[model samples]
Target: MIPLRLKIETDAIEPYVVRLRSFEGISDESHHTGALDAALESASAETAEFSGATGNLRLFGVDPSEVNGDVLFVVPSRGTAHRLIRANSRHNTLLVTERCDQLCLMCSQPPKKQHIDMFPFFETALLLSQKNSTIGISGGEPTLFKSELFDFFNRAMSRRPDIDFHVLTNAQHFDRADLPILRRLDLTRILWGVPVYSSDSDVHDRIVAKPGAYDQVRRSLSLLCEAGAKIELRTVLMKPNAPGLLDLAKFVTTALPFVDSWAIMQLENIGYARQNWDTLFFDSSTGFDIVGKALDFAISRGIDTKLYNFPLCTVPTDYRAFAPSTISDWKRAYVADCADCSLRNECGGFFEWHPKVHGYERFGVA
Candidate 1:
């Protein structure tokens, strides 16, 4: 697996963001501010020496090839560095906060009561992002810090209008009062990725371990539509919600017609999902009938439907086109069966922690 955080040595006493620059670009004085010259001498082959206004630092035990041109966050006290934006990666996500309102059964990143405000650092990192990149803003729920989040957006978008964001939220905190600020910002560049597991309010609330969550999401969706905000409705396929997929699709088509897209996603084996694997993991390979029918219904009604985190071989030929390689490069992995497969290059494969023993029963070549 590719590492996102690495141990480093630096003289800085406070946290700061820096974009790694090559030897040639480092000498260009215009790029000195908020940029580090990562060029190293041949004598110190293993250690990458970085220099900038912040001060000189050394990143030991890392090949320069892996992190060249990547944006890094230096936390001096922890002696660790986090890759805020990877140049080679097409998908880059900034986790805004760990605090969330609802506790979902199959949550890959479980909720935490404590939250360290990193919106300022994240705003800096977003400014240094690659041109025209769509950075994903995720969290236990980003809307928890609604005021700060909105301020960050307004400030960042004012300077960097070329960039876009795909925010993952539970849709609980949105209200009519937020409409003025939402309207002032460019909604075209923002896509809210909200979750609605089931059409039935009781079942949906039960899955999230929160009563009235479905109702809040409905209200928020209405508010977003009124503000002309773009939305991507996301549903994670699981045992509890599998049977209701078609019904939820119908609900989306009839009631939530303003949705820009609908994503039927596979469950990741991590956090709460790992603990509830047996109960929550739905093998869509064997249960593709229901999933496919739901996709068909949504697509026929003009919804841009997609399958996220699904391997190509597990999907039927007719629906394979809908399953793109949506997994991020850092955590994505492949099994031995994919070694000689013709579509290996195009497949998203699987999450690094996906169970090999009790995984899909029909995993093989497409």
Candidate 2:
């Protein structure tokens, strides 16, 4: 049986659905769209046997013990997005090396060019593992140490098979050596986070500081897709990549069919981003409109996407997100706008420095 993901439109509605699922064996459920009053309690000790629950779908209080025991594999909530996140609220990312092939302007970390060994890094990660483990092997580029990454995964998998893995790599590392690693790693438990700046290679390579980065991306993309590794194309949407937004969306939709999702992030005011904010960052003025258009295009293409840093109100209707609309829109800051905005209470708002760059006027009547 396939994993079932339930979708409930609103947070308010999630609870009631949870209540309804507590009953034994719900039959003839209504296939409805949109959010409702949602209630969720802790799972009951009395487990129900079921299977195949995933993706925008909730098991509500459905027990995983029930799931493992039964062949059915998943007892699904009628319509909720599958929350695939592991129950344990921890993630481990081992910095494989400081050495990066690229000089991305937005990198939060200082430049690391010398290749670092993996033995100590691997040991630390192993020590940090708890029951439900999700680990990301990050680096200037993890693939740079293709041999080390493969070896570490083999060791990690031997000890824990259920562990979910996220391999952060610049698609540039796809080569014969890398193939063996891809072959050895199980796809179900792994998510390859590959940074793809814009659909255009020129834009992507420019960010990576490697001129031929695009060629590597193209070849590796084919290999990653062929290997069936679940891939999430991490596209950092910035002022430079902004012009190619529509093209990027269409490119992903058309070219990277194997990609599981795309993370369209706004340039954060960190690392290279801080230095390049005037040139790279975008607030509501021109940035918001462009992002809204790109996002709309992505949705139209039936592409799965995520918006980070941007506030909620600034986003168009197509974007299904919980983030604030503008940098200045967040409540965390002691900014001037929050006092008058009706959304202040519910909104998570934006980063503290938002108002410093894109001030209150951008989010008018706030």
Candidate 3:
């Protein structure tokens, strides 16, 4: 089994073998968790120690192994959640901000009015991140951070020049005023994942609960593309957007032809999605025909396409390869029957939060 990416808020990290290491081999004093040789014998959530050559470090139950790497422990808070910022780990994604400008009906992390500056946390995370890793800057909306975000990006890129960034934004904040900043940044490695719900502005705006959002997103995409930044168009499959999925695909192939890739993702049943389940949830077992049509159309047009969070058996054999294991381990789950599935290794399993309102009756051996 692959090693767990990062452990957080757990009472104990013991019994689970982990190779904790810094992005740079050198140990920094700020994250020192000294020698664990003696700490492991009586390790507990309240008190435990991990000893390294650098010094004796105190931490929860983390069983270290001879992984041939220097360890870096990031204690982001006063509490005992030691987040291992794995710069070398492929699953690393920096969640920059939880505040969003758009109130999308199906938002996984709903918008909040609280004023919180997550830059400090992000700055530390980015600095500790692995060089040459594909770093994702996501949020309720990352663009809301504006100049602060740009500064963070600038600093992070300078520290790890080989790092690539993938930012998820609604693209509502992109305009002429932001063009200068966009041009100055290292956008070569940055892939902006922007959402386009539908070609029709009204339909798109309605879904996001922002009246002029569609127009703004359209403008944002054009501006970002003009700035030579790589852009990936995303569309979340749901009831409102399903009817117009094909239309959106057509519009994307024609209007957004410059987009590097198009990702059609399954809905994560959480946050605001739970509130609007009856309205947004569509049983993919039968409703996937529409999705299939849209994917078919996009493929016919030579668009670089990806299907995310989709069950392997639900997608046609031709599109099965396109469905990668997109679900993160923290939230991914598989039904009991999946134990016998030959293609289970290749499939992206269900989200743990799935209420099973739409049963997995369609899932079977491929």
- Which numbered prediction scores highest in lDDT against the true structure? 1
Q: Summarize candidate 1's per-residue lDDT along 1-366 as a digit string, tens digits.
A: 888998888899998887766444244554434444344432156677777776766787777666767888999899989998998888789999999898999889998889999988888887777889888999989999999999999999988989999999999999999999999999999999999999999999999999999999999999999999999999999999999999999999999999999999999999999999999989998999999999999999999999999999989999989999998999999999889999999999999998877479888865
Candidate 3 Cα lDDT to native? 0.71
Ten residues in a row with the worst lDDT in model 2?
A: 66-75
Work out candidate 3's RMSD over C-alphas: 5.8
TM-score of each: 0.95, 0.65, 0.83
What's model 2's overall lDDT? 0.58
2 or 3, greater by TM-score: 3
TM-score, candidate 3, is 0.83
- What residue runs in model 1 are displaced by over 4 Å at the alpha carbon? 24-45
On TM-score, the leading prediction is 1
Query: Could you give candidate 3's per-residue lDDT for residues 1-366 as a string of tens digits?
Result: 234333333233332222344323344553443232122223454544444433334554344332223223333243333333443346656666778888988898887767566666566555545456786778888888788988888887777888788889899887788788888888897999999988889989999999999988888889998899999999888888889999999999999899999999888889999889878976666677788888889989989888999889877787788899988765788877678888999998888887764454576777
**Preferred candidate (TM-score higher): 1 or 2:** 1
Residue 273 in candidate 2 has what lDDT?
A: 71
Candidate lDDT scores, in order, read: 0.88, 0.58, 0.71
Q: After superposition, how far is residue 57 of candidate 3 from its true place, in Å?
A: 5.3
Clashes of 2: 54
